[model samples]
Target chain A: MTLSPEELKNFLIELIRTAETRLPVDVYEALKQAYEVEDNPIAKQHLGAILRNSELAAKLGKPICQDTGTPVFYAEMGADFPLRSEFYDIAREAVREATKLVPLRPNAVDPFKKKNTGDNTGRFVPWFEVEIVPGSDLKVTFVAKGGGSEAPSTLRMGLPIRGVRNVWETVLQAIVEAGPKPCPPVIVGVGVAALSDQAMALAKRAALLRPIGDRHPDPEIARLEEEMLKAVNELGIGVHGFGGKVTALDLHIEYAHRHPATYAVAVATNCWAMRRATGYITSEGKWEIISKHITG
Target chain B: MTNVYHLRTPLSEKDVRKLRVGDTVYLSGLIFTARDAAHRKILDLINHGEKLPFDPRGLAVYHVGPVVRRKNGEWEVIAAGPTTSARLEPVEHEFIAKTGVRMIIGKGGMGAKTAEACKKYGAVYAVFTGGAAVLAAQAIKRVVDVYWLDELGIPEAVWLFEVEEFGPLTVTIDATGKNLYDEILERAKRKAQEILSRLS
Candidate 1:
């Protein structure tokens, strides 16, 4: 059955508003852990304040950090879904309204002019990466990606010989260099594939899929994630890069077949305020809230 | 009560020399906001032997791009958090020398050349609190004037703020070669290693 535009729009608005204010469960857990291990009294104290802030924000239904971030939606639509056109348009409209309602710090600025749109919509805002599945339902994941962590994201083009060790080393170096800049303890997403841009995309996609502290399916990747975690924390760029044992809360790696001669590695860091939410729309046009973490 | 110093209009080498690390300075008068892009443009002007938009000598340059709020046709600063100062390392020394800026206010620590410039030029680099945007905004009582570099964009333009008491910053890179950020970073590294070993 076709979904009513109003129903879809309401759901989209709720999702956007919720994503604006809340920290995802996984991100909250990582921040808590970072607070426990932080050694520098000042940094540790600040982290504690941040934790309290997150908790309060979640409870109050307020945006966790000042930078509410650009709204991004990843949709898994079914071939049988009747209201395909209505879905995307509803989502975009919801984002535009939510930008003002949530008072989300207007992040989308005119890239060339660097002027704030004040509505958080500019060129290519609310980026959607869509995939069609077999079922008669649609699953959409909304991510509020912040700028602080996004600034330090890196992509490295390496020879095939570089292998996993190269990836580990490169990641560690990147984290060490990033130091307090990205506002750790961060969630690092590693994308490995043949194409550099594709790999970077995969890395970001990986960030949305995994829960905080979850490991990769492959034992090798899981092990590397652990090792890299330890190495990065060793840099002593603790919570907020002050000094701590929890520089990274989780490392999610997404890999694809690489060209025989080349390996492209991409790293995306998600800050402490990992604002993300997910919802599923069924064939009957009713939206199911799979997960939500909405703060004031 | 916190000691408040009313520093003069254009701070010179002599004025900067009197300042000490860890001393709180309540700068009145004029200061310019110059981040990555503005720095590049200012350096280009210096390179071309062209007149700069503002006098640099005895000037305080803040490394910030504030989110502005407009009310009744006047622009007010909302949150003016300091941008990463290290990004300006490429042309910091030259910018300081050519511009004759006496003080640099930013978050995080700058590099050795900046420290060297501060030492040689008798200037100081003050570090405002990172992530404390609201507090920074309070320091800005009014926007005296703005020279919009419309072509360069939000981050590129040098916006001048008339600050009431614009600082509670630690002098990380002082005129005497004492680098607080380096000390903090080194200590953090050692402490982090110890904690990581336990976790592993």
Candidate 2:
């Protein structure tokens, strides 16, 4: 049976609602682990409250955090997938519906007009990044980025010889400077690319898309993730900047082959809420919401 | 060292004065919402000596744009969490001096001006965990009133809310003009320098 457009729109709506109202399994587990391991009274109490707040949010089916987030989707579709052409329109409709149905806070503002669009959609809203790959199914990942966390986004350019140190400086500085603002115990995403915009996008995806504990496939990159995570936690920015052992839940790095002339680095973070969902529709029309997290 | 305080609105200087950085405070009473737009609007009204739609004296103001819905002709708060507080640092001291608001509740850290204002005006700057919207909504017992919804939009509107047990808020800037974030972040910056030195 062919997958209907209505079905796809409705599925995206579910995905958006799931992302906004519920914490994913991986993120929830990481937070639970953080809470269990924390020793400082200030950090412990704050983490406990975060856990409690998340529980209440899921129980009430409310958006995990008020900034329900700017809607961004990453789609990997098979060349043979039937809905490739319709994905954009379908997502726009879905986001518009979800903005009201999930009751997302209107986040899209016309920069020049300085007015909120009322709906979450504006010129390029519910942004989608698509990849046509070899497969028979379509997988879409939705990330809802909050404004508070987005405020700390950083981008810098330096000589290629300085790439390694630049990466280190940019990521660490962003996190430290953010202190308790981007919401502590954040997930830091660092992107290195030839171009500034590409670096920024990659950094955002790394910070917001990757699972909390999942390491990059490249062992070298994975080691970098582990190293940064350690150094970040050691900074003692703590939960809500109260000063503790855990400042960031995890650190991730994503990079593209850079030009010989330049090294552009970008850094971003996601608040502890980790609002995102991944779903796929098989050629046979079977759908699954694969993002992990379950309430205990 | 951490202490816990439960304070009701129309707070006296003594109420917040007793609060120190790292102390937790729970507020029960009226607090208003104001982001960049609303704060500027309030400042403009204050400068012109025009009456504010709602009184701010002795109460708290939140830096947030909550997710709300209208049901049965009433506003329902779906999620309400603190936004970054640093954005308001430039004008917050003036806001404090003019309004006499005893509490400034938000996340992130405010600058020296806010700290001095807290000291001068007998108020404190507290942090409500960022992204804990549902918890904030639970504390909101009712949407008491709203202003400038048309001009500033939902996110920027001045929303007066009646709340109870509304905290777990940690004082980052105390009435003594001490700032927890500055200390914590400064130490972290130094430690980071140490680590970065070793790593390189």
Candidate 3:
């Protein structure tokens, strides 16, 4: 039985609900660790509050944050998927339905016209990114990107001769200068690529996609991640920048083979409330929520 | 040592003067939410010498754009956590002076300008937990009124709320002008340098 468009929309709605109300287990565990390691009273109290807040949101079926965030969907689909053509419309309708059902804040607004869409859907909103893979199933990931965290995002373009050093400095300055704005205990995603937007997109994916402790597959990249995480923690900006032992819950670095002449580094930061989840649908119409959530 | 103070709205200089940076505060009474747009409007009203929509003197201004809905002709608050406070740094000093709100509640501490205003105006800047919307919503008892709903929309509009024990707010900037985050961040910059030197 092939999954109907209605079924796909339902799955997407569930995906948005999960992203809104629940904290992924990995993210929760990382926060718990941050709370445990912090000697600062303010950081500890704030982390404690965040943990309680997460539990409350889950229990009450309420969004974890007021800033419900921009709806971002990343799809990895099989080339032969039957529902590929209607996927975009299905996703958009799902967001509109989820906005009313989940009671999401209407976040989409026209920059020039200064008018809210009343629904979260608007031109190019609920940003969809797709990559065709070599499978017969469809998988979708939803990330709720908050405005406060996005406020501190950075892009630094520099020459490639001092590429590694520049990337390091850029990340450091981004976090240090970010101060408390991005919300501490942040996930720092760093991307280095030939082009600016590509670097930013990669950085956002790294910040929003990977679990907190997940390291890159490449040893060199993994080592860079580890070093950045260590250095970030030393910055003294603990949970909500209260100044404590844990600054960033995790630091992620993703890079593409860059142009020899130009090196572009982008930083995307997510708050402790990293709201994301994945759903997979088989061609046979079977579907399941894949992301583990913080239950207790 | 951490001191916990429970404060109520329509506060005074004495009420705020007792506060110090890092002290925990649980605020009660009315708190009206505002962000960049609302701040600008409030400042504009003050500059124009116009009668405000509501009496703001001795109240608290929350830095938030909450998610709310209406059911059965009553407002229902869903998620209402603090927004970034630093964004209002440019006009906050004048806001405090003109409005006389004793407590400014938000997250991510404000800058020197806000801190100076807090010192000068007998006000305190406190941080409600960032992104703890559901938890924050639980403390808010009722939506008292609303302003600029049509013009600024929900998030940017002035949402007057009646909150009860609405915090685990950390007083980051106090009436006496001491700012906790300023000191904390200053120390952290030294560590950033150390990490960079070690990296080199």
Candidate 4:
């Protein structure tokens, strides 16, 4: 049976609102760790305040940070999904209502004019990527990516010989150079593959992975994550780059087939506040909360 | 009593040398706001030998693109945080020399050339607190006068604000080659390496 438009719209709005209000569990863990290791009194104090703010926001159902961020939606719809025809439009409407109900900060600005739309919806807003698989359920992931971390996100073109070592060095340089601007301690998502753009996209996708500290299915990638995390923290760009032992809470890498001569690496840094919400819609048009970390 | 100093409208080399790095000074004076585009315009004007809207000598320039508010038919500043100053590094020296400005107020630190020019010209670079836009607005008592650069837009225009006791910024880049930001970064880097080694 086809899902009612109103029900789908409400789910989308709820997802966006929750994404804006809550800092993901992994991001919260990273920030707490950063606060623990921060040496600079001022930076440490700032991190504490941010942590408290996040807690208060979650408790009171308020936006975690002032920069509500641009809404990003990722959908995996089953081939048998009944709402497939109207999914995209429902997502857009949800974002529009979310802009008002959530009171999300007006982040979408006209590139050339630099004028804010004030509703967080503009060209290509609620950016969505849809995948169709054989199933009767629909999976929707909503992420509100902030500008602070996005500003320092990097894509590098590495020589074939450089391989993972080059990826490590480049990420180290990015974190070192980023200092406190990207709002550390940060969770770094690394995308490795043949194309820079696709790799960058995959890096963002990796950000949504569950925060299973020190656990990786791939031993090599897992080892690389551990090594990179240690190296990055050692940079002493501690909490907010204020000089600390814990600069990164964790590192997640997503890999793809690459061209023999090209090693495309993309690093997307997620701030202490990684706002994300995910849910699944079953074939019967019933919503199932797969993973909800809003109260944290 | 509030510390008030009737400094000249535009500060000069001699004026700048008299001030220290951490001194809080009330500039009841005329100052201009210019970031990327306005700096370009100022440079072009200098190149073309055209007259500037305001005199540059001994003047203080704030690096800000304020979110303007309107109330009762008058425009006012709501939040006027300092933008990252390094973006204007390429044009700072030229703007300083040609305009003969004495002081630069911004957030974060500026480049070496700008610091050098400030030292040579007897100027100073001050840093207002980053993310403290609301507090900064309270110091701006009035608009006094405004020259709206209608074309270049809010951030890149030359905004002339009449401020009263408008500062609590530290001297990150002083007149005598003492750069506090550089020192902080270096110390942080060393400490970072030490922390990393311990972890490894």
Give lDDT tens digits, candidate 3, residues B69-162.
8999999999999999888999999999999899999998888888888888899999999999998999999999999899999999999999
Which pairs clash inside model 4? A234-B196, A236-B192, B10-B58, B10-B59, B11-B58, B11-B59, B12-B58
Instruction: Give stretches of model 1 more than 4 Å off.
Output: A6-10, A52-70, A86-90, A104-123, A134-137, A281-296, B1-33, B37-62, B71-80, B94-108, B122-171, B178-200
lDDT of the structure predicted as candidate 3: 0.90
- lDDT, candidate 3, residue B192? 70
RMSD of each: 5.3, 1.3, 1.2, 6.3
Q: What is the lDDT of residue A147 in candidate 2?
A: 82
DockQ of 4: 0.12
Pairs of residues at least 3 apart in sequence or in different chains that clash in candidate 2: A24-A293, A25-A292, A25-A293
Let me know the TM-score candidate 1 reaches against the reference structure: 0.75
Error in Å for residue B153 of model 1: 5.7
DockQ of each: 0.15, 0.83, 0.80, 0.12
For A28-116, candidate 4 gives per-residue lDDT tens digits of: 76667667766665456446656766765677566665456678888899999888888887887787777666555556778898766
lDDT of 3 at A123: 96
Worst 10 residues of 2 chain A by lDDT: A287-296
Evaluate chain B of model 1: give its TM-score: 0.88
Q: Model 1 misses residue A185 by how many Å?
A: 2.4
**Candidate 2 regions with alpha-carbon error over 4 angstroms:** none
Residue B73 of model 1: what lDDT?
A: 96
Q: In model 2, state the lDDT of residue A26.
A: 83
Candidate 4: deviation at residue A100, Å? 2.8
